[model samples]
Target: MSTATLINLVRNGGYQVRRRAVLTSRLLQDEKRPTAACYSSTSERRASRFDPDGSGRPTTWDTFGIWDNRIDEPILLPPSIKYGKPIPKVSLANVGCASHIGKRKENEDRFDYAQLTEDILYFAVYDGHGGAAAADFCDKYMEKYIKEFLAEEENLENVLNKAFLEINKAYERHAHLSADATLMNSGTTATVALLRDGIELVVASVGDSRALLCRKGKAMKLTIDHTPERKEEKDRIRKCGGFVAWNSLGQPHVNGRLAMTRSIGDLDLKNSGVIAQPETKRVQVKKGLLNRDSNIRTKGHHRYLMQVALPT
Candidate 1:
């Protein structure tokens, strides 16, 4: 069988989430093992017991508060299955807190895998500002965009640009539906990574929130932070009709609020010519390692590669 077909078979066998529609009986039965019935029953009972009202039944919304809900959540896997090659794994953790000045918590952050093929794992992190609408939308819809884009793309560079543009359009459409009201003013900062076969890592970023590559005890930044105070960023902001205000510490900010010079969702900022669009960078991890391939290399190099190869 082809790799794609094998992956589809595995997904049909219960390894993936069905996005187009609810899983049909035939699909479920093909995937289900005898133990699935017992596991499902236990899961249902657990969910019921955790229902807020103490009822024996739990609604779909109620499942959000429980950890077990992840089990039923859709799993994104690569279209191709690696034969004799182990699938690369990735793990991520994120924490977001409300800003001290805001009455409403407008910032939202998410890390999700958009595509998982045998050779590549595509993931992105979006940090929203101004309001939660843009960020929340990114969290919900960016992955879908990535998957759709990748299905038709073979080059990583083209895929990155296409996905980003799609995200931009999606945000704009969502904003326009509100008659150019509150949500339109909101925007997000994005940083994305494409991990390829433990050999190459490509990253793109707009605003802050960074991706770092640690190899052989040395740390290297994968993407530049687009801060307003930087000379280039400052010039760009000014040329775009945005003013960079400086603080006592000599740090620059846009409207005395944000520090970054680029982002995704800020329509108000974009109007001033400060784009939220990200700059992209690609790095070859294996190439770097090969360049420093020496017996005298520190133990940290091995540790770093091992850490990167295995998900958190």
Candidate 2:
């Protein structure tokens, strides 16, 4: 099997994206906190007590100690962030983001974007499972590795792939190396993109939080969901002695645990064929709205990748 697939979408094709119709809501449930990535610690389980088995680390931020380790506050962005430096006055744009708790007790979705320099930028979205620690850890530290790996002698693709893997290893089973991945029962999906000189776009992701681009009235999907139902993922899981099956209501689960097959953290499932390796892709944007474009967009209030309901 291919370890990774790379293509220049702008050159190979115009800007066509994989067109798949599915629910983003289903994706979010995998990040549900309190042990299993899917289902609430109480609600989803009592609703499905007849289900099989399966199942973040900590951060310096936890030192504040004013919070419950299990539940966390949602990242609520202010309107002030909508303003920033624009490339050209004619094409300048603003960025805006907001997070909503909705019916969930705490927000497991986390995101961050940083401008490395006048010509470079990085943006990432993380949907956390089991707990918010995985998202929090990756959100704070992945960029450090990305910057460190950028001094590489190879190319952008190699640099990004390695950077993602480095952090995955750093956070997975932290009982061995770092203090962050100790959240043995948690995991998080990452979708990251790097923009350079306003024309080059690079994206890497694990799990299903998607990256979508609307170009000239076309919806372009830049990432793939590493969900359990994917054939390759299923085969790998089974080969590793993990079983993939649908719950009574038709939701696919790996070893009856997580919905997505790839993510950072989730130490218990690593031996069962789960991995933190990400899918990396590059795009050359010879021409596009660089001055005003945002890194990614979420749909509705639940965010594009969040699940609306689970099988009972």
Q: List lDDT for all candidates, in order.
A: 0.59, 0.64
Q: Give the TM-score of candidate 2.
A: 0.62
Give the TM-score comparing model 1 with the true structure, all chains together. 0.57
Deviation (Å) of 195 in candidate 1: 1.3
* TM agreement with the true structure for every prediction: 0.57, 0.62
Q: Which candidate number maximizes lDDT?
A: 2
Best prediction by TM-score? 2
Model 2 scores what on Cα lDDT?
0.64
Q: List the residue pairs that clash in candidate 2.
A: 25-306, 25-307, 25-308, 26-307, 28-307, 56-134
